[model samples]
Target: MSRIGKHPVPVPQGVQVQLAGQTLTAKGPKGELKLTIVEDLDVTLADGKITVKPRQVTRRARSMWGMQRTLVNNLVKGVKDGYSEELEINGVGLRAAMQGKNLQLNMGFSHEVIYPIPAGIEIKVEKPTSIKISGADKQLVGKVAADIRSVKPPEPYKGKGIKYASETILRKEGKKK
Candidate 1:
């Protein structure tokens, strides 16, 4: 039995959820999102809650039960409250800025790195070293943040690069004398 799958996801007030065939759609103040449920599991909505269960007694079905339920939960929460990811630029002279609808990054490269902002996703550079990415889709928001960080991932030695705001770099010892 999947522990997470056993708990139904509650649809909060002001949020509307609909299930059609294998697709689940949620609409709320933030935005509207849709998810295609896996065939190995059964999903249902009742009394303002969404539940997931395995269709058969099998390893794959059991494994997908909890994950599918979490995905449904994410859709509900995403439409209601949205999601955001923060990044921190560490190192001297490394910074970020917004130019029109694009993100400009300065990470010791010869040419400035220009990243075009995607539709439905907002990127804000509160400070030159701090960035905040927000969107109604949790996956998109996280992917955008990861792409930004991948441009100049933090190094272990000097920790001079871009990283998540809540992430801690494991510094390595410098060259011995």
Candidate 2:
């Protein structure tokens, strides 16, 4: 009864899917992604679509079935449409900037933090407070944004932290005098 697993994945043009033994390899214009097939979780390719049907829904299978299908779908879409994440810095004097492909961050530290951008991904800092990340791989783009935000996770007090632009943070007030 998993909504995600029940959904069918459409086979897009220029993308190749190969089911070899217990492994699935998806190749697209962007890149190739591979995953090991879980036992008893059947994936069938029919009529330009992929379907998932688990023989028995155990606790493990129930939890993983939906995730696996979602990952596969993302891979297919990533190769075609790509992905992006935006980050914002909130604080006085705490900002982020791009020095070429490296990110320069000033987050309450005496020295500026430098983060190098990975290949196949592009980072653009609109200002000291806004950063945009774009890449063909959805997972890669999300992971990079997470790593950058982890550098200065939003503080509960004063809400000074690096967070996704669309994220909302709970602000904690200062202690009473």
Whole-structure CA lDDT of model 2:
0.85
Q: lDDT tens digits, residues 81-165, model 2?
A: 6799999998899988878879889998989999999988989888879999988778889999999999989988777889888
Best by lDDT: 1
Residue range 1-177, candidate 1, lDDT tens digits: 999999999999999999998999999998888999988988889999998988898999999998899889898898889999999999999999999999999999999999999887989899999999998898899999999999999999999999999999999999998
lDDT of each: 0.93, 0.85
Note the residue pairs that clash in candidate 1: none
TM-score (C-alpha) between model 1 and the true structure: 0.95
